[model samples]
Target: MRPRSCFVRSSLLLCSTLVFSGTVARAEAPAGPQAPPAPQAEPAVEPPSAPQVEPAPSAPAIAEPAQPAPVPAAPPATPPLGPTRPKIDVYVTAYGELQFAYFNYGLDQNRAGGAQRDSRIEFDTNRFVIEVKGGLPDYGLEAEVEVEFEHGGTGSAMELEYEEFGEFDQELDKGGEILVEEMFLSKKLGANAALAVGRFYVAVGTLSEFSRPTDYLGTNRDEAETSIIPNTWDEMGVRLRYKFPWGLRLTGQLVNGLDSTGFSSQLWSAGGHQRRFEVQRATDMALVVRADVTHFDGFTFGVSAYHGDTTRNRPKADLVKSCEEANPREVAPCGYVSAPLTLLDAHLSVRKGPWSAKALVMYGHLKNAELVSQRNARLSNLLGVIRTPVSDNALAVWGELGYDIASVVGLSDSHHLFPFVRYDYADTQFKPREELYDNPRFRRSVYTVGLSYNLMNVAFAKLDFGHRRLGSSAFRPENTLRFATGFNY
Candidate 1:
């Protein structure tokens, strides 16, 4: 054999042996796990003079394997039993009023000597009030507190006592008052009902429900309600309220009744509010029921009724009926006489667009009013009561309407300018019994006109003129001009 041929044959034989050995080694290796295949090397091309061999194709590139995705960790365990703390929120608000007034008649009807002679001008701090409200949302609990300071909250007052036939008494302890208008805690009974306990406003009239100065159109509160009852009346009591889905609300309350010792002819039950002492008497209880309907937008109407015994709440148990035979040891030979008081009222309010209006009518009756008058007439001079006879019935009606002139004059919505008129009639001696005299001084009618300006519902100013007429034209008519300013938040 030629030397070149022998060399070529030997090279081909060596390559074949190498390939067979690699295959056998791979096949005999352990078969437990497999790794990614590695790229194989290309075979080397022979020299052109030795052999005509085509170049082996290059091996394709191998890619690295993708990394595995991460596994999520497990969450921490929670306790089976735990108390949840409720979220509590608190809010505070305040309002105040200052007043300047000019009147053309005497303030005291008894001392006027049957003629309106005294004219007066006065400046006063009408009221300053602060309120705090708090709520626990999760527990459905709410709390509110309101404090009021009137007429600077400090002074000495002079009172005229008719029990001693026009006597003067100095009330050094009671002039201006620091009043707790409301303080109550409420708990939700369900989605539509709630219960409240503590001192709260009696739901009897418009003033008790809407007490802010800006709530009404006139410079002052309604004269009829203020004259016949304690305006913004409040007593320690429990109240239950429920609201229906169709815009009806119902309320019921049980509260301490009025003191008969304070009842009088001029103001009827106005002075009956138990403010003469630090602690109030609660021997007599009152029941109040109220219902309101708001089915129409911007309108609400309601009726309320109050019934309670008055004789038992007097300062002393002295109004009992005479016994046939009296015992010295027994305080009341016969059981005390019944002198219950009853009141009923209907009220309506509207605030639609640029117009606002309010109307109310009230009637009240006192049982055995002649006997009450006789007892009051003989009271101690220091008690400060009018000795005149009290009638069995009282009636009051008032209405006010206003229109926003700002809307008509192309003013911004944030500014409100309302021109309003109000009418009031209150007859403390609406009807008299045969033994009682119907005093014309107790019947009064008032007409008022005013302009009110408000800035964004936070600040307000008002100017008003009022004329008052007595039941009989023989008495001179009275007139007043008032200016008031206030803020609410």
Candidate 2:
């Protein structure tokens, strides 16, 4: 074979081998004309044609219709839909406690009023609470609702005001009671300001965190506060709060005041929570203002004031006859008077490492209690007893200190054991109107020492012994033992 032909064949073979493996083939040149025609014949053919015919009349020109608009390509199909966040975010939490008490069971009690007024043991479901919080970012608002089941049943608490002068009597706990502790809607005013409206805790005292069993250090709340102010007091109204970046905050509220008619010489304003109906009227609104300093870590100092009119807090129609008949010369008519109530309180809280402390002092002034007492004297209820010579001033002071022994000893951080002591002294009759009888029972002091232990921070147990002293050295005091357990989240 010729060399060129041999080269061609080798190249073709190589290409064929690669073709099976996806090689692209190249184009080849056309072959030369196989034969050459005679040139003379071409010339002779060219000379034979001469005649040409005229073209036929051209057909009338026709215009083409306008082309239709081009259709657009559809947008790429949207990615498959995926899960999305909800419009409103919801959170839930709960807290509750159970307790047992051995009242007036001290050695002294066993000797004096043994088994009678000084010795009694009882078990109780202290309080069960449910809380719900919700936030809506699009609307720039938040809401919260807190409900409490106190004492434990629907037939729960039947507190007869006449049960005891200065003690908590479980005899009223036939079943339990339910209360809507707080329900409020707050609008964000700015980065550090907010306005809330609806039923909410009053911002007057330390217990504003609430009088919950879990909020306080001891087994019981400061007697001074619970006696003069509503425990966990909540009222329907509006609150405006502004906070500074440095940890100072100012809060103010406008809410319903306590009812003078419900107020007693013993509990002062505690029984004045008007729960007679679904909605509480705001006819007698009160103003509460509070200022707090929290610039220091783990320390808080606060002051609060409350001023309100109690005359309108009561039902004039119901007590009109009682006041008309009292006919007292030293006091005004029963049903109507300015009877403004003013309260002031200052509190301090310190939590430095393993040491914690709390202290508070409060005073309440009532004008025209002489007139209010005149009305209460004639009024009687299973829950209320008329104390003559109503007090014009009420004062309370309490302090507590605790140290975390587990932490101090370098035990597991999750476990805590704290030994604490607290002293509370409250007297509603600090100053009484002349001619009004001041009972020493109302001027009592409490001393408490306890140990509280927590496991894993979810549950806790508490044991405490308390002593109560009444009426100078003449009247013997009472003593009690308390055990409590609770859980929170």
Candidate 3:
């Protein structure tokens, strides 16, 4: 009886649940006005209630996946800057050479100490140079300070004790002190005109005006021959130059004369005679004029002249008295003395294809007072005053013939080389010889064979073999071999 009652209860509960679900589904369907609807199928069977559609089981909760970060693009690269152009350069140039030299003395002089006057090999430093150049090639300024060697001999080398000043003073004092080589500025004024000022080498002659070392043929100027014109006579001054359309040019300068203190004679300076002859002050001046003509294709010619009063006319009476008393035979007393000098120079060059020829001539003269000494005795010693007379002056002449053999080898201008032969003769009559001015002639002649190469514009290299003979003396064997390289940029 208990089991039956439980079965009946379970049946009743299931029936009720079914009925509830059916009613809910019916309510969810579309509804119409209450009417008796006809079923048209042969055997109408109610379609199974649409299968219940339910939301998908809730997915496991998940955080959104992190997004990857974007990558950055690379930047462009830059190139290095190149060296600046047309810039001013203040640089040091170091170079040197080993030299072998031979000296030939026809007659060994008496009283001279046993100083090696023969063959020798010399190595020298301090031939180095420091230079500063600004501005453009059209117009600019250039300067150089050279090193002087501390040890050398006349036979093999020149010892520049200063070891600072260069082969050329550029700027220096008479006592071998360096002051300034080039303190001047230059500017281009026109298509063919320029101007310059400051301390510079006087433009009084062809040989003295060359600023390049490789262009020179000899070591030193003839002191006697060049005394009147004075090679390397530098002064603080101004220069103006102009080029013409017809291959001609002209240059002029106004410069200070030599100072009183620079004169070789102390007595002249003490007596106030030195300054009395020339304008005296640093501003006391002289004039120089030069004309150059280049025409007929490869031919060039030049003429230059200079005149100035290098002294004041004031001669000390007492000094003259003292000079006469000291060297009565050598020095003669006079009331008035002249204080002026004049110079003339000319040169010509012809360059035709592979051959070039050049010739130069120079003359110099001193005015008024004759040379004398302090001992009332004639200063006729070779080193003393006796060399001069009315016609006792200075003259120099030289010639060079060069051929560009390298041109045949198709060398370019920069690499172009030339083989040259040259001859130089100079006579200094200032050394007094009483009779017809015979004994006192200081004469020298040199023959040179060399090859020169143009390294660049305003730069060159030279190798030369020289045979020097002094006043009819025999040639020295082995002679001298020299090598030089120089540049101005």
Highest lDDT model number: 1
Per-residue alpha-carbon lDDT of model 2 for 1-489, expressed as tens digits? 454454454445444434533434442322233213323223422332311211222212212234566889999988768855559988998888999999864444223323235477989999989999999877678999999987887532323233465332324435677888899999998789999999999997788964655456687777767878888889989999999998999999999987777777677877778764334656678999999998999889999999998877564323343444676663335644568889999998887888878888999998888778777776544434344445789888898898889966778889878899999888978878767777776787899999888776568888999988875665676788999999887
Tens-place lDDT digits, model 1, residues 11-64: 454455445434334442222223112111112323333232222222122222
Steric collisions counted per model: 0, 10, 25
Off by over 4 Å in 2: 1-86, 105-117, 155-174, 276-278, 318-335, 380-389
Report every candidate's CA lDDT: 0.83, 0.75, 0.49
Report clash pairs, candidate 2.
Answer: 153-175, 153-176, 156-175, 156-176, 160-382, 160-383, 161-382, 161-383, 161-384, 389-436
Write model 3 residue lDDT over 244-355, tens digit each, in one string: 9979989888876543222322112112112122222443467889998975687778998876654432121222333344544443344323345566888876768867
Ranked by TM-score from best down, the candidates are: 1, 2, 3
RMSD of 1: 9.4
Q: Which segments of model 1 are wrong by more than 4 Å? A: 1-85, 111-115, 155-174, 324-330
The count of backbone overlaps in candidate 2 is 10
Evaluate residue 448 in candidate 3 and report its C-alpha lDDT on the 0 to 100 scale.
84
RMSD after CA superposition, every candidate: 9.4, 10.6, 17.0
Each candidate's TM vs. the true structure?
A: 0.80, 0.76, 0.55
**Model 3, 429: alpha-carbon shift in Å?**
0.5
**Pairs in clash, predicted candidate 1:** none
Q: C-alpha displacement of 358 in model 2, angstroms?
A: 1.2
Q: Give, for candidate 1, the lowest lDDT window spanning 10 residues.
A: 35-44
